[model samples]
Every structure is written in C-alpha cells, then in structure tokens.
Target: MSLLRRLVELLYGSDRALRRMLQYWAATCVLYVVCIGLVLVQVSRGMTDGETAHRLIVFGSWGALAFYALIRASARLGLKPDQLAVSQAVFSMICTMCAYAISGPLRAAVLVMTVLIIAFCMFAARPRQTLLLSIGSLAGAGGVMYWLQAHDPLRYPPMTELLTFGYLAGALLATALLSGEMSKLRSRLKRQRRELSDALETIRVLATVDELTSLVNRRRMHEVLEAEERRQPDENGTCIALLDIDFFKQVNDQFGHAAGDAVLRSFSIAARASLRANDVLARWGGEEFLLLLPDAAPEDARHVLERMAERVHGMPVPGVQGRRISFSAGLATRRAGEPFADAIHRADNALYQAKEAGRDRIVLA
Candidate 1:
C-alpha cells in the first residue's frame, strides 16, 4: 500500500512538473524553428547537390517530427509544464552535441548556438537539471572536438590562432546578447499576462458583487442558484429564504438614505456571519436579501433564519444609536419537481406573512 501511494504521488508530481515545462518548451521550439529556417535559407540557396540537400531536408523534417511527437506524448501522459521544459532542455542539449559531432565546419556555430540554448533553458528549468544539462553539453562538445582534432588536425585547426579569434568572439558575443534579449521578452510577456488576468478578475467582481452590502448581486445570485441546482439535482428538497428589513422605508425617510445604507450593510454583515460557508446570501434588491440553503428542510431553514434575524436585531449601527435593525424573513422549501420561480414566490409570500404577523420574525410557507 505504501509503495503504491508513493508511486501515485510520483506520477502526479511528474505530471504537474511536465505541464509547466511544456509551456517553455513550446516557446523554445518556435525559436528553434526560426533559427533553423534562417540557416536553411542561407545554406540552401547555393546548394547544387540534390542528394546533399535532400539529406539535410530529411534530417530537419525528421528532427521536427520527433520533437513534436515527444512533446505531444508527454502532454497526453498528463505531464506538468516544468517537467516537460526540463526534459526538453536535456533532449535539446543532447541533440546539439550530436549535431556538433556529425558536422565538422559547422562545429563553431553549433557550439555557440547550443550554449545560448542551454542558457535559456537553464533560466526556465530547475537548477539541478540545468546544471546537469550544461555540464553534459560542454563535455560532449569538448570530446567531439578533441576526437576531430586528433583524427584530422588540419581540418580542425585552432580558430583562436586564426583571424585573431575575432569571428569566434563576435559569434559568442552575439549569442549572449540575443539570449539576454529573449529572457527580457519572456519576462515582459509574463508580466503583461498577469496584469491582464488581474484586471479581468476585478471587472468580474464589480459586475457580480453589490457595492453597498458586499454581498453578491441579483444576477450573480441567480447564476449561483442555477449552478447549485444542477449540482444537486434533488434540490427540490432545498429551502429558500427571502428577507426584507422591517420599516426600512420609514428609517430611510426619518434618517436619510445614507443611514439606511449603513443599516443595510450592517444587517448583511451580521446575517452572513450567522450562516455556514455553504449557505448562499445575496442582495436581492434595495433593502431585501435572499438566502439559499441546499439540503435544508423547512424547519431547519426557519431555525437558521430565526438565528440570523436575532443576530441582525442585536447588531448596533454607528448612526442608529439605541436602535436595532430588524428584518422579516420568509422561508419555503421546494416541493418535488417545483420550478425555481414557484419556490421563490412561495418564500416571498411567507415573508409578507412575517411582516404582517409582527416584524423581525421568520414565517414558513
């Protein structure tokens, strides 16, 4: 059992890691294609040997297909992005070393490109994995260069001794600058995405939340109720409560709308505190509120509302000194197969009864 649990955790962890890694890998693949295309455009224009050109094209196509398949398979296995990025970086380093070994004159360019690629991968991948890949790529490059120099010294003469090392230095410098610019671009893009997400969330909150009571607005309440109904198909057994502040209009006329708003806000806070986390509370309109209690019977809903009313009545508003805010609540349980509107209507009628019988009490219908 312990071994099985460990295996499950390992699999889940790897999946999460791969998902994070895959995002970076996707970006890296785009950059890789761009670089390869540039090289191909430059080299292919002068090539007359159909056989050599065909071989080059075939290798490039195969490389792209292989990378795509590997990435797709990883995604299918539910790998997380981070793990995918690290794995791809390692694979890229391996391929870079292989390419350097197979090609002679292209070794300098490949070496510089591999270094830059590895550096970018390191910026995105875990520290340990990045270190391992960097070391492996460097060792592989050195080994291949050594072997080539030993076999054919003339073909692999030291570039440092020729042309004052200007070309080699220039290539390395350009690679470094390009890698740094790419890193900055990635950072800027990530920041922009985060800011946009935050702005959208803010707009959503403003649309769905009431500014005065801090409760959900009417539209949001309907959306939530519908979602809950779908989740709990037997919601016919659920209870709905519609509450209106008793003498709210009288208070508004006597003390002004500002005081009325304060009373409303205070009552909402108290009522919310009196309910459970799963219970829903919303501002149903001016001086009115609604509560939806899933899996609650009529008796239970009444008890909950009675408690909420008592709490609100006991709450003291700053401007309404020595005066308590009271509300009449109507409680109704849905009958089997009853529509949402009918249940609300029943609750509203019960609320009217509460106001008529005596204010600040729960009436069940």
Candidate 2:
C-alpha cells in the first residue's frame, strides 16, 4: 500500500489540480471497463448484440484513451484540472445524447446517466457550474427527443418523452439545491476551524508567557531547566542563576506599583540584551527572575550576570527619583551526575551571600 501511494504521489506531483485530475481519470477508466465487461457478458450469453458490443468497445476505448491523453497534456501545460473534469462531463453528455437519438430503449437510460452526471457535478463543481451542467443536460434531452420525434416517431411516443424528460428536470433541480447547501456548510466549517486554531494559540501564549514582561513564566522555565539538566550529562556544562531586583519594595513604596511595573519591564529588556542566544530567562516571582545558561561554567555564568547587572544599572526607571535599577544574581554550575535541585539550592545560597555582602552584586558557587 505504501509503495502504491508513493507511485500515485509521483504521478500526481502533490498538487491539488493533478490529484483531482487523477481522481477523474481513475473513475472514468473504471466505469468504462465495467461497461465493456458487461457488454462482453451479454454477447457470451447468446444475445445477438455483437454490433452493439463492438460499438461500445470502440467508442469507450477511444474516449478513455483520448481523455487520459488530454489529462496528461493539460498537466504538462499547467491547465486547470477541474476544467478538464468538466470537459469530460460535457463529452459524456454528448455521447449519452447520441445514444438516446439512435436507440429507443436507451433514451430512459440516457436520462438516468444524465441525472447521475448532474449529481456528480453538484458535489464537484461550483454552484453556478452545477446549474449550468443541469441546464445543458436538460436541453440536450429535449433536442434528442425532438430529433427522434421528427425522424422516427414510432420509437419515442409522446407519453414516454414527457415522462422521461420531466423526471430528469426534477432530479436536476433537487441535486442543484443539495449542492448549494453542501457548499455553504463547507464554508462554515472552514471558518470555524480557523477561529478554533487562533483561540488555541492565544491560550498557549497566556499559559507559557508572563503578560507584563513578555518573558517565559516560571512553569515554562522549570521545563527548560529539566530539559537542560538531561542534556548536561552529554554536554560541557549547564548553569542556573537567580536574580532579584534590589530595593524593589522601596521602589513600590516611594513611587507607586505602576512605576515598579515600568522598572521591571525596562529591566527585562536590558537583561535580554546582556544574555547569549542559548540562555533562558523567565520571571520566577515578584521582582525575581531565573536564568538558565546551557554550556556555561560558573565563571561564564557570573560574567553574564555581571553584564546584566550593569545593563540594569544603566536603564532609567520612571517611578524612581534618581536611583537607577539594579539586580543581584546568584550563579551555580551543575556537577556531574548531580540532581538539578542541588544546583538550584547552591544558587539560592549564593543569592543569600550576594544580598548579605551588599546588593547589586553577583556571587558564583
């Protein structure tokens, strides 16, 4: 099955037009083959219809081969596939009209085939196109009836013509209405799916990102930490750092909470510029953030933190009077085969040391 699917994909080239053309080609071939087989069976059963069978074989074979060639040529020329399918339907309706003109009993069969063709078009073609196909088929039936009545009045009686054509008109109308409703339903479903996808994306952002600073939240940071730890055994080093804004509570008290928020936002921007591309930064809690540095030793992690502290010191806080914002950070490199929690504990201890020794400093453990 896989091989067959690959072969089909190769033939169809993965474009919608090519795939749709392939579908039409396959269905046409199957229908023709079945008709030819039935005709053969009738001949074998002693029915003296060799001429009819011969005509069926010749016309069906020729039409199938010609249509297949057209499909291939159109694909090479970049023609629309749906147009090709529509052309096939028109050609089939023409053949049905010819059959109805010649054989009296085949007139009813032709009407039935026309109804099927309209139904197929209703699903496959646009609403306007489906209506056009139905109108054309009905017109063709009327023309064939007129020709039969003029040439061979005995073959098609008035009652037979009226019944067959009237029934076909009703069938075409019903099929057109169904196709229009189905098209409307399909459009509604497509719009709803797009809306659902957008809603899901919004929810994901809200869950994983901090709204104030637009940084990853603590929960996402923990996932990154765990993943980094698993990768560290095969890597050179992994380090974790804790950063706390110095005198953040004082900023909130002196100015206002709104000014404190502005400070946090400004600090987040400066810190991002100080870190490398592989570093991960997330809001840990109020006025506190965590940084994960993959492939960094304790010294390398401390350098990054120092640079970040300098950046924070340079940034102006609107709420604060004259003092620039600063943060103290604690850094710890993970040991071989050690649990991630131990590194975080060491980093926390280092943070306490930085706070004790005086704020706005970095301590490495």
Candidate 3:
C-alpha cells in the first residue's frame, strides 16, 4: 500500500494543476506504451529490420526517458497545464513522425496515432495554435508520405498513401473548426464568472451598508449587537450611545432635502473619524445613529464623545450656509448580565431626556 501511494504521489503531485498535467501526460505515456507493445508483437513474428530497431530503441527507450524528464520539469517549475499542453503537442508530434517514417507496412495503422495527436492538440492548444498544429500535421504527414512512397514504392504505394493522407486531412480540419467554437465557449464562461462575482459584492454592500451615508445599516447593526452580547462584555466596559441630529427637521424644512442629505453625509463621516478603531457607528434610521464602544472605560468613552461634540459643533455642511452640524447623544454602560437590547433601550430613554433638557448634549443612562 505504501509503495503504491508513493508511486501515485510521484506521478500526480500535491498541487492541483500539477496533478492534472501529470494525469494528462500519464495518459499520453500510456498511448506510447500501447504502441510499444504492438511493436514487440510485430518483432515476435520474425520481422527483425531497422524499422523494428528504430521503434523499440528510439521511441520505446529514449521516449520513456524524455517523458519522465518532462513530468519532473513540470512539477519542479510549477508550470500550468495550459503551458504544458503546447509543449506536449510539439514533443509528441516529433516522436510520432520519426517512428512513422520507418514503420514499413505499419505506416497505414500509424496514421491512426497521427490523427489522435491532432485531436488531442485541438482541445489543448489555443485557437491559433490549434490552427497551426492542424496545418502542421497535414503538411508533415503529406511530406513523410511523399518521401516514403518515393523511396520504397513496393512497400508504400503512391495511391494508398494519398488516400490515407486525404482522410487524415479531413479529420484534422474538422477538429480545428470545433476547437475554435470550444475556445469561444471557454472565454464566455470566464467572463460570466467575473460578472457574477462583482454582482455578489454589490449585493453584499446593499445588504449591510447604508447607501446614503455609507455606514452600517440598522439590520447589520442588530447583527453586530447580538454578536457582541453573546461574548462577554469588555473588561474595561462596553458602552453604547444613541445620537440624533439636533433640529434636523428644521434644516430640511428651511434648506430643502438636498442640503439635509449633505448635512447627514458630512456628520456621519466626521463622527466615524472621531471614534476609536474598535468602535462602531451605524445608521439607526433617518437622522439617528448608534455607536458601540468596546474595551473602553466609562470615563474614556465620555471623553471620546465630548471630543466628537467639539469637532462637530462648528463643522460646515457643503450647501447649508451659516449652520453647523451638531448631534445629541445618550451613553450607557452594559451591566455584566444585561442584554444588549435592554442596555440600548436605557440609552434610548436617556436620549429622549437629553432632547427634552436641550439638544446637542450627551446624557448618561
């Protein structure tokens, strides 16, 4: 079992693309092995000629070594399957042509292997490469047939070789056409996958982010609060705040909704900049936001909010002249056993109190 596993691992390496390339080469190698066996069968029948020696020694012996070398190079170099595909097509054709040149009576049957090579390259090579290989195969086979017929008219008759090359030519050109179609399909599928990925990313943003202010939406905020509640509250303290823009409706009524939107957008950006790295500020609804502070002491959280208030008080909105952005907030520390929703409710109550007392101030819950 261990020996079998090691051999399998040697042939098909650990990398996915490497494994696929090796598997393809293994299949091609098997074709050579099968051809070698047929050559042996011919030799057993008393055919001891240079043709037999060439097949067994050049193709059978040296071909095996080259095959192993190519496999090792592909693994070590981390070559992709597509790159190795072209190399394999070129290498296999050379050995096939060399063997075909001397096969004598086996020349007719050897054309089968030639056709197979063309078919394999049709799928593996790019469209232009497939066209080139197709033309090369037809030309190479025609040249070899003409040479053999002229040299050994008794063994390779002119009429028989012509008919055989004609058949192989038809097959090669037909496959080239089909290969062009397959390449088009491959390109289209890749484009669709990229478009689908982009669409999915857009959908994710819509689900979790507020398109208006680009903050976490109310739905995603609830998810964050629930996740935070499941974990233990920060040791220093976990605080949450509810904030509303002071007299926001008056701004909208005076300046129209466009200026109101610019104010909301500017406030969200400034508030986010003033918050801590671990803090989260989410859009709760229109004119209201939620802020969650983790790993912050009450005093530290208060100071953070106070700094935000000072920064926002005199900040100008883009189109709203003579008015600045200001928000009222209520802060509360989560008790050890309290649920997040309950803490947020206490914070909400304090926010109402802050509004009644005066807007643009922070009240503790």
Task: Please list the Cα RMSD from the true structure of every candidate, rounded to 1 decimal place.
Answer: 9.1, 3.3, 3.1
**RMSD in Å for model 1:** 9.1
The pairs that clash in candidate 3 are: none
Candidate 2: residue 242 lDDT (0-100): 87
1-365 in candidate 3: lDDT tens per residue? 59989888876767776676666677787888887766666667644365655545575557556756776676577765556676677667676666676566776677678668756765557888887887887888899889988998888799988998899888778878888888899889989999999999999999999999999999999999888877765433799999999999999999999999998898888888899988999999999999999877778888889888988886778889988778899889888878888889999998999899988899999
- lDDT (Cα, tens digit) per residue for candidate 1, span 85-159: 566666666655555544445555666666666566646655455556555655565666667667777876655
lDDT by residue (tens digit), candidate 2, 96-167: 675565444544764666766666665457777777887888888888787677776677786778787898
Q: How would you order the candidates by lDDT, starting with the best?
A: 3, 2, 1
Off by over 4 Å in 1: 1-13, 18-160, 232-236
| Residue 312 Cα positional deviation in candidate 3, in Å, after optimal superposition | 1.9
Pick the TM-score winner: 3
Q: List candidate 2 segments past 4 Å from native.
A: 1-21, 38-76, 234-236, 316-321
**For model 1, what is the C-alpha lDDT against the true structure?**
0.71
Candidate scoring better on lDDT of 2 and 3: 3
Backbone clash numbers for all candidates listed = 17, 0, 0
Best by lDDT: 3
Model 2 weakest 10-residue run by lDDT: 98-107
Model 1 TM-score is 0.64
Model 1 poorest 10 in a row by lDDT: 160-169
